[model samples]
Target: MAYQLRGGGGVAPDLNPLPPEGGEQAPPPAAEVDRISSLPEKARLRILSFLPLKAAVKLGMVSNRWSHLVNTPQWPCDSILAIHIRPATQGPCGCLVPTHIRSDQIMPLLANELGRRGRGPGHRLLRFFLKVDDAQTRPADFYSLLDYAADCDVEDFYVDAGLGPPEVSFNFQRASHRLLRLVLFGVGVNQAHRRPMSQERSINTLEVITIENTSLGDLELKWVLLLCPRLRTLVLRNCRVLTCVDVTAASERLVRLTVAECPQVDKISVSAALGLHSFRYIGDLLRSVALPPTCFGDLRICFTKATLVDPIQYHNWLDALPNLSNLVNLTICSNALKIMSALRNRENFQTQVAKLSNLQNLRELRLVLYRMNTLMLSHTYGFLRMCRCSRLRNLFLELPKARTDSFVDAVNGLAEEPAMDGFESLVKVKINNFQWQCIEIELVHFLFRKARSLQKLILVAPKGTNPERDQSGNAIFPDLNLLCLEKAPANVEVQGAQLVLWL
Candidate 1:
């Protein structure tokens, strides 16, 4: 959305009236001057609409011709209608609104604006946005304002009624008449709205809906899905309302669903009817998720905790991973890497392999851990040896502070078995939370030696303030202190936080 101004060639010469005494000494004819005003009213209004509301209003005050077009009901400009009213800080226009600008002052302003533009004959509203920051604002005024917006036939509505107690719920059925997309922040939906969703209502036009910081239970959510058949994308953030998300109704269009930071949800069940192509959840590890026996394009799940002592929990996770083998990109984060470390002896190597072998179709793997050490490295080696990530191109590992010697030894151990064919397909590798140490050079050296298809390697060298750079300004990493350092592979490249290099 870029806004640029193109000059109208040059301002038309202003025509001044000639004195009565002058016969032929007349200024330019009025027809030759003020070309913009001479344009049709609709054209002028369209031009004014391109300017911001503040600028358009200011221009109306200055130009009499424009004022008629702007103030009159015949104005053809489809201006973006948005209202921002807050008693504190600033008004919707970001103007310095006084602290005393109470609901009385703001409500009437909103009501009058909506009533005039929205209630006018042949009014067509393309979009509508309202944000109220004052918590003390009257509920009656707010609801009334929404009623006016509905009258305007708004297609997209975004509202953020200020934070309040759980008892304060705003009915959504009022605006569901023509809404295509609805986003609500810090507002709850009324119970009356729930029944309408279950019954056939005018909410079929809704294609996208997002709710955040609101309390809505599983039943209300099920109704939302059942009500809006055309819904394609649904997002619920930090909304702890449902213990389970069971979408067995098989919504054909609901393809993308994301539920994040919802601590209350423990189980998620989806049917083939939803045709979900992408699903993501970020919560505790103990929670269970059920997906259809079909492949999804992307599946990203984050576990809050992965304990080592719980073999039952590990077994549960093991059972879940195979069902999601159709995932193209997989991200797993937990102290569960600790479980890998705990199982790192010769006796448990095959067992560790059996657990992760379900990841057959994975192309990108992101492993986040609480710490990085020899034990974690051995577990990583076990994972790479056992899991079939043959298509894996990008590998991201988040490591904590650990000994450099152990880190290098782990890389060496993984690279020793080239027949494992784990890093053979690896192209890009990024290791975060890394400290620049002498042993890190050997780690990079071994990776560059084994991963023949490697193209780019990024390492976060936190301690090194100065790293050598090539003529192209790419960082010369693995800051080897040795006089004779191993030569990097020809096809590989190294980059630090500052530069990019191709060898």
Candidate 2:
């Protein structure tokens, strides 16, 4: 049978074959017809709906008929448009070569696509994302896209300017009411543009707002919260210019607030946020934090490198511990415990530990360590003793790579210490970046003696470490005799890289 290329680059048996022996060609057999191309238009659209916009666009290269079908007014893809402007590549001579999609062309291209979709009830855009790597991207271009998105009634919008020069300033007063989520990176929020909106005209539909690496201030953030009466989550990160985040007027619907790496932010005040359940801060200790007496169920505090050297900062962090009595889950760094141990006054150290014991509701605790030293085991034991161990169910400890000499010293130093009380209610414990060293073995033995209720213990090897063999094909497993597996409780199960003990 002869074949011919079909509209979608598929082969089909020829229906009209050349006559043989001068006889009229038999009527084309009904069973040898193309089936997919003959499918109903709605069915074809349903097939296209399952594909992404890029895949659907590739169909236009198949054939003219398929191209027309893909570009029809009823294009099946959800109304999502994303354009990422790639950075220039280095040429052989060390010169920079621009990418195919120039930054300047983005505005016109977005306008054309949005224009083709038209505007109105059924034509609303579900989401639009734009990221420009070029530092020369014009501020007008960003504002134009924002205006177009508002005109098109886009629901979710994300714009990342790559922390370029001359940050793009956003005016939320004109935001679309249909906007549900907005994420801006390296974009500024102009305080002058934040005018009070009428009660009926506010963006009550906005639920989540995240701004990072910008110059957002306390008043501006408060203004944003006031403008969005129904906002639920707000995250501000790397905003160096932010001096304070006062959410005292935050809406009752606000549930989570995160402020990370904002070095200049010295205070966070939350008073009447009834729905707030989680709060996270990552940076130097704040001068003051006025949290509600209750309602927060989860809290996380991670100190930056500067906190380790600044005694006053870590002391401020220790001072804030007693206020978090309502937290059900808490995540902190080992540096806090190390700092607590530095206090020369025994009375002050005990007072700090007594304050930490107020976390009676803490069920899950995560400790991130920056580095390991001989004193770490003692600091860890002191921290665990301060927490309500009978109520703590999950414990996660992330260890850092350490020198062999340091590990040896730690093992020897802790070998003579008395065994601590066991965790009665702890069910699971995970240790990350576990290197099979003397100190690690000693720590495992300490946990075996303690954590009597531990049902599962997981030790994850450091990233890039070989499980079976070293790079030279030598076996990487340590001497199994050193593990002392007999110390593990009968009810406990140990799991790790290629090593699982049922004991």
Candidate 3:
């Protein structure tokens, strides 16, 4: 048949076909097996070390060689444990898996993996990270794992309990002396363990601590500060029970402190501490604050409440300004401005200007303007006149999207008003949410004419609109330079959207 089909597309005869008679065949030798498996056990473990915990666990099932390498009686790798726990999503059918099963899957897998590996005597642990979802059933096995990590003296401990009411408390009483940082979310200190542990040892090794969305009262916070003598950074966010923050002890070592959204915090007192470099607060105005005389290089104070019925009540609030003199950068929100406006109107504006004159070292000033139903032009100009920064180089003006035409006119009037000293030192100005209105154009013209030393003008238009082209597809504010070409310096540059204009 092969000879008859020679004229057509002929099939090539197999030269190495199986023998005609059934014959036994020998398997390939072991030497020709996978090269990776042939590598040294340490080299294989090194490769597995880079894989995530999930993948590393999955690797044990690959082959006998890999199984023995990773799942032996005692792992030969260095002591490093990293655990990431999150809620298991539903399967493709959209059926929710039982929380017990989800916990069973992760907890035992980790415990077993670490059981043999961490059994070695004098094992040096590196880090421990536990990020768990707010599932109702937080298994006892999970706490056991945390206890194990704590016992092992893990260096870095981070726990984020996602968006749930606090059901569990973490006892750091026996926390490792080697722990350098502790960040907790939705987890509070165990009150039962606080008294005994607070008496026994202090967390002198800790350098940073952050707590958020947890119920921590003044006593608990003060206890933490007293414990962590070397703490350099402390961040408290939306903590419900933190009514008062008095940082006299930690003030010496703390370089940065941020308290945000803690509305109940009625008072903050930080005595003379030269090491403090930055302090940021975002909530209701504190009843009182006493900052260090040395001053913070960067200070940010925001008020949660928007309205101020009586401007005269802002006297005490304005008194907080001069406490910090050497400001490299300062950010004041609408609340501060409102109070400042009240102060300006109350005392002929000179006292308010003098209060801000202490900011001789100010380099950058950022002001946020929001729904001001009764804001006056004099109030705006008064604040500007107070910023007599010899080194003032940058100014950022941010206006809310809901700003009215009257506000724009007020700003224009403020810019038109003369100052004792013009913005000679000002080199750059950034206007955020630029409306490109007639009043805004006039204000730009005024700034260009007065700020002789101004080098760049940056206009950040509102988002969702083409910066280069407006909603109608026309060039955005085509006459930006034309409006001030005569008064603007020849070297001045106007930058808006993606377009740049030069006079």
Top-scoring candidate (TM-score): 2
**When superposed on Cα atoms, how far off is each prediction in RMSD?**
13.4, 13.1, 16.8
lDDT of 1 at 187: 76
Q: In model 3, which regions exceed 4 Å deviation? A: 1-83, 91-102, 116-127, 137-142, 192-198, 272-274, 321-323, 345-353, 372-378, 401-422, 435-447, 452-460, 466-503
Model 3 lDDT per residue over 1-503, tens place = 01111223233443453543458544435764355566777767666554444345566787788887555423433545655444456333232321223443666665566666663225545456665654753656557666777777666677766542246667767677677778888888767435654375777788888998888889888777877789898999999988988887787788988889997898877654568888888887667876666667898877767777775655655555545567798888877766775565454655644657677778898877664323433455567776666677888877666765563344434432547463778888877777655444555666777678888776766544344443335564566553232233445453334223343
Please give, for residues 1-503, the per-residue lDDT of candidate 1 as tens digits: 11222464234333454445756554547665556677776667667645544455677798898787655444443544666656655545544322224555766665564455556324545456667767767777777666766766666677776452234555556663656778878777667643554364547778788888878788777766766778888888878776777766435777888888888887777655347877877776546666655567677666665445563454444444435466677666645545544444436454533645666677888887665544455555556666667778888876655543443454444423324466668888877655543333444666687688988776654444344542235454545442132344555553334222334
Rank all candidate structures by their TM-score, best first, as comma-separated numbers.
2, 3, 1
For model 2, name the residue pairs that clash. Answer: none
Order the candidates by lDDT, highest first: 2, 3, 1
Q: What is the lDDT of residue 441 in candidate 3?
A: 50
lDDT for 122 in candidate 1 is: 45
Per-candidate TM-score against the hidden true structure: 0.64, 0.70, 0.69
Score each candidate by Cα lDDT: 0.61, 0.67, 0.65
Output the lDDT of residue 228, model 3: 79
- Report the Cα lDDT for residue 284, model 2: 77
